[model samples]
Target: MYLYKFNDPEKALDCFTAFISRFPESGNITLVYYLAYEAAGKAGKASQAETLKDELIRKFPDSDYAKGLQDPEYFKKVDSDLRTVDRMYAEAYELYQNVYYKEALARCEDILQQFPGSKMSSYVLFLRAMCIVNLQPADEARIALNEVLAAQPTKRIQTVVNGILASMDVGDKPVLYADAEMYDARYLKSVRNWTFDEEKHAENTEEDRENPYKVNKEEEYCVVILLPEDMKTMQVLHLQTRLTFLNAALKAEQKDEKGDYQVKKEDLWYKTTALQIEPFANYGEAAVYLNRVAVDKTLLKNFKGARYRIFAISKTNFSVLKRLKNAEQYVDFFVTNYFDDRGQGEIITGRQGAAAHLFKYEADEKHDFVLMVPYRQVNVKKMAELLHGIEPAFALEKETYDDRYEMVVVKNVGTQVQSMEYLQLVSRNKEIFDRLSGTSSYMFTITQSNLGILLENQNIEEYMKFFDDNYQRNQSGEVGVGDGDFVYAKSVAHKFVLFYPNTIDPFKLKTTFEEFNFAGLMVNNVKYDDEHDCMVVSGFRNKEEAMRYFQTAVDNRKLFRSLRNVDYRNFIISDSNFDTMCEKKEIEQYLQFFKKYYLE
Candidate 1:
């Protein structure tokens, strides 16, 4: 289960198989059977899964677990039935109030069996304790009441449950801190287990635990560059980049001969307000810095209309205002909290965050790339036939600019590497050059957003200029050649930085290391990650891909070879094992999973 939760299905199934053998009569055996079947399917053991499904049906014909195999709505129906427990609990509550303890107990047990984790679960447990307290033995009542407390009921339910537990604690010490210890255990306890500890649980809300602000206005101040929500995405980014550059300049200007900055460079950080440049020790210090930035020839003058805004706020009040995200509310908070209504000594107080230095891309949202072919050069039918020859998923699209062009797009081209592989296919086939000499262009690396710009402008050369500029920048080792010209989100996909003969020289790497990507790998990019800094190739779709890349590049040393003096175009190192990328990591104990109930 742990392995499954961590997304390693093969290991999870192995553990499940072992558990089945060791504890054949485990109480959770029925649930375990279904879970193992699920793990098998996820791990791509389709034959094994089909066998497990049959075994599950034959062994437990009447179980909901078996019914679920055919009926997709089985769990939804179970949930719908459980929803009636609210009114059922009301009837049970009436019986308990009228001193019908036996009847109430029956209803509570029925609800417990039918609806295990319902919203009114805590309330039902509380009623169960109440019914048993008067009718059953002291020990029975104590056990029942402890169960109620463990459910972590509402404050009203908690007060009654805590009172009952206090009466039963045989500890001779006067229970002065009973509420503190028992009532808030749910919040404090990190791990789930049967054993309870007094020190771990204490009654506290989430807000009380998380708040990291205190009110103090006269001591601290900060310069905030607000990124108003309405600003265009590029404008905000440009402002942030400019502000960052100005900060570096300030550090250089203030540093002593010994290379120590006088203003403490550590104070520079980007928090929620876009960028908090320098947190100052006094109000006058912030004022001086802001004034310097506003008037300085190189700092603020370059950015058009670089006027900044400031406000007076104490530390604690600032957190509330920031959370509210309302300028009017902050004004009101300043009026209500500070003594002088003029609002002079205000500061934002919350300080429980690490500095954000880099912007990143998450694969949750994808920026897809496509190839645009001018219609004057090639028609959709010809393009379609050509793309189909390369990869069947590659197809021609003719939506944006019908008169002048059609685009070549592949279904879910996994990475930039896979995109390049299409071009590689065309490059390898020399007949394509003569076959379509009319082909005006093939994009080097262009995203869907770039396609929109090309379509709207209807000027291919104008759009190609951006790529031309970027290529020159890439060759010249420019940090941000494509920044102003291209519109892309700051976030980039993640790649592993570990396990490397870390070097930044892309030139040292031999050709055709990616001769292997022709296999089922279909990676997005195989370019140098942080070319100015590291020796890692950035981007892999998942852990398995990462492992495969590692095995080829690091373990097998296929990625790097001594810089040789000959034959670069004949980049092949020979026939390769595709099992590295597409092959499933199989279960070591593959047969044991089927030992008990499955057929070969």
Candidate 2:
């Protein structure tokens, strides 16, 4: 009978009813009937659920299921409220996906409250923790992460938890001191499990306790000490001894917020100071010297001479020395020696050492050759090509000397060239000619002749004046070649033309030329040849003159009658509107046109 309920509840219900009818006095009959009814209801047959409820109440009034219906809390504890739990869990999951962390957290909490012993309790707790981590404070997140970690989750969940812990900077002890000697063989061996040759040490220590110095696993602390890597043997020994003393001092002086001696701060300071010294001597003298030389000039300049104590030295000390030279050469020399060789203890001070340093210093100070070019006078591609060809020389020379020179070619195109386009071309081709040759160290200045004048002056004000003067002069009169008393106007036509050829409507040609401020305009020729069967038009003065020339050809009709039919109205309208629109649109078109013609 129980097998019927386990496999097929509908069939089991009928079997239970038949058995009850045959053996009504059986004590287990009530229990069998109750299960049959409950299984039927679970299968979503409402009639079965009603029948089961009626039978359970009538025949099994004292059963657990019957009693659960009387008290709703009892139903929840016995897993009789599975539908409600599923609905709540679904809602919480949806909220989590939408980033409604607080809502998700509340819903998960509800599951635990309503169904304390439900199988879904573990999952609900995990979700609640994740939501709390995102929505609540750092302390809450820490608690949440720890709870999740302690759960002994599935492999996938464990992997995710490990990743989250790695990203988090929680429970980390700040490094208080670092001494070079502490990393040595003796000291390293002293720290349990920290062996120089792990394989060999493992064999030797296998019989002993794996980690003898193992302190409290939960107690977190860090010690920072200077390690001697490249000092003389004597210097290394001195630093090692100092580190040991500093370590002892730190252990003695360290304290927590409650004023209890937990970790020594003085020991850390002492270790840090010892690391800074080239050779450890008296602490008082070292402290004084460090205070004097470790002064940050960058901070001093930034704060307007605000006196501040030096805490650390950085690589930027080299750059500071170079900048100090710009103010006073002697100051540069003094600062460089104090920091570079004497302070760093990288080189001894003498005539030969001094000569070598000076040679290196002079090389770094060499200036790059800058070439300025007028946009109107030179093609950018051609100039770039020329510069790229010289790159080999610069590359070869850079290999030999510490000092290097560069060719900085500046094209003064104003707003004519798009900054992005210009930069793209320069960067793409810089490798071709960006080097120096032999021992010359001199990079060439290849630029427009006009820009040469501005570079020679090195006065920005003068360059601006020159630019304005040239533009005004060009606009005032047609640019022409001087020949005694006669000035022949030079053609200012774009070398690369854009318009379709042989469809030359004199009026349209004039409009296009005027829009670009061309030196000449187009005019139609009245005379035509019968054998050629075409009328001639010439670009001459302006739009009006060009239209008049076209009209002349049309009136005569002796040239080609077909030429008279060509529309010139569009051309005339385009010319009249050219100036107003030129500033806004034509410049962009000109750039595109130039790019297509030259750069493509």
Q: What lDDT tens digits, residue by residue, belong to model 2 across residues 134-158?
A: 6666566667767766765544455
Off by over 4 Å in 2: 1-80, 149-155, 169-600
| Among all candidates shown, the one with the greatest lDDT | 1
Report clashes for each candidate as comma-separated counts.
13, 29
Per residue, candidate 1 scores C-alpha lDDT tens digits across 384-404 of 566577767544454555665
Best prediction by TM-score: 1
The true-versus-predicted C-alpha distance at residue 52 of model 2, in Å, is 26
lDDT of each: 0.46, 0.38
Error of 2 at 373 (Å): 95
Q: How far off is residue 13 in model 2, in Å?
A: 22
Alpha-carbon TM-score of each model against the true structure: 0.21, 0.18
Model 1, stretches more than 4 Å misplaced? 1-32, 35-51, 57-64, 70-72, 86-126, 131-600
